[model samples]
Target: MGVQWSDAADGPIGGDLTAVLAYATPAGGAVLTPIAPIGLRDRDAGRLTFTTSLGFGRKLDRIRSNPAIALAYHDRAHGFGASSAYVLVQGRATIVERPDREYLETVVGPAAARFLGAPRRGPFWDRWLAAYYADRVPVHVDIERVVTWPDLRCAGDPVVDGEPLPAGPPASQAPPKKGAVPRVDVAKGARRLRGMSDLLLGYPGADGRPWVVPVGLRADDPRGYELSAAPGLLHPGARRAGLVGHRYNAQLVGLAMRQHTGWLEVADDGSARYAPHTDAGFAAPANKTLLLLTNGFLARRGLKQAQRARAAEAAT
Candidate 1:
């Protein structure tokens, strides 16, 4: 139904900026975006609306900060002309709340009820969430301002000067994840393990904290990675400590993790539980690892061709 483009602003530090899924609150009188092109509408004259495929709660903070937004859409009709990478689109953005059943249905389609966090065919089957937001809102980003590539100097435009957005207080990564972490990132680590088909895990402790321990893994295409292990990967301390915990692993579980990040841990009884890591990359003293033999064995039974090779080496 619509096209999406990358967010051009990369923050003062200039890293890959994560695009936001939000809209401005009309009542709040935030940075107002137009509802139509060429100043067709006046200030607060029209509404801006857009969406991020995430939950309303997840995007609230961003919208609070940068109510003035620009959207990127693709002109599928126009080709990139070979030498170009990808096409672009731009528009003023805002978030809107949908109160009517008919309207929300039009925007969200058949599963509208579900995404509104509604359940089907239950005692409250027909009911929709009354007010499901700590903020209680849905974003409506209207397409008003249109800026495209060449216009913004092909998106290579640089910020002349601006104050930095103060970093938010670093929140704890997880009090503890009750369910599961994103398997997508795990798939990424798994692919890296495939390449090191000849190495075994090396650590100081047998077990301290469990995490996704990536020593030096980076590759393309991540999928099917679990928190399991390889053989001979355990340190003397880890070997002894692991006996106390359950499976104490997930597929190629990270080892000796310190604080929280994104990882899962299994208990000794073949029950895999999730534990969060605190640090960013795979850290040590409390880094994660594969009991060389353990990881190898699991790989042979659970992983495919590439992991099998790594597993084979671990067996030794």
Candidate 2:
């Protein structure tokens, strides 16, 4: 199904029923799951719901403590060239027990139809729905914020969008400009590299389908990064890694900083030969931190100005 970019409640998802839910693990990492949303859209409440077998996993237990979560809907191809759409919904979730019969009927039945690739359910669908509801429980996701990129092609560009054009004469190619300031020091912590904390890596799974994994850069070494989950968490054979993010934000930090390569090989021996320092990826960690600090400063100034304007209006 084709996806249209709009500000609707469900516009970002298009006809995609599957999503990757990321939630915090007890040890400060994250766990990603492939789940099917069972058509629970409370537009007014800004919530979406899905169901999974009650005893099938330990994700329910993780939800009880840390509510901060993110659900992503990514369609790598819409048959429109290499263009794609990605949406991230940072939200909170909870498991609801003893749901009403009507709610179950409204959600589960249609989800099964979509999963089975049937436009309309036949007579036997009722039995399938009954079997699905036997041990599953609903997980409510209240959306806090949603961010989407209509075209992800820009993620591969060497220079970030909105930056100045090449400065040299047309005949010769100009080298990409470096950040003005020195690299900002990253604090000591696991997966806490100031501006380069989280990144999305995409590669082809064994089935040849596009697979994305989220990872964090090591604070101590900019060249190295750690996967939030296990090495083969999503797909055991996913070895080539492509970092995906807004081109501008990505320019500020990453391992492949400025060089745009087709794919970086991830070693099966738990090692990786990242792009050399000449590439922006090596310098990205420091540059990213500086950019973040600059953005923060500007944001604070804007907030203060807004506050002052409010006070002035009240005085008048």
* lDDT (C-alpha, whole model) for all candidates: 0.26, 0.43
Listed per candidate, the RMSD to the true structure in angstroms reads 21.3, 19.6
How many Å off is the CA of 257 in candidate 2? 29
Model 2 residue 210 distance off true place after TM-score fit, in angstroms = 21
Stretch of 10 with least lDDT, candidate 2? 167-176
Work out candidate 1's RMSD over C-alphas: 21.3
Mind giving the per-residue lDDT tens digits that candidate 1 earns over 101-133? 554455433322322223234333222222221
Task: State the TM-score for model 1.
Answer: 0.26
Q: For model 1, give the 10-residue run with minimal summed lDDT.
A: 238-247
Off by over 4 Å in 2: 1-9, 76-83, 117-132, 153-316
Positional deviation of residue 2's Cα in model 2 after best superposition, in angstroms: 27
- Model 2, TM vs. native: 0.44
Give residue 50's error in model 1 in angstroms: 4.0
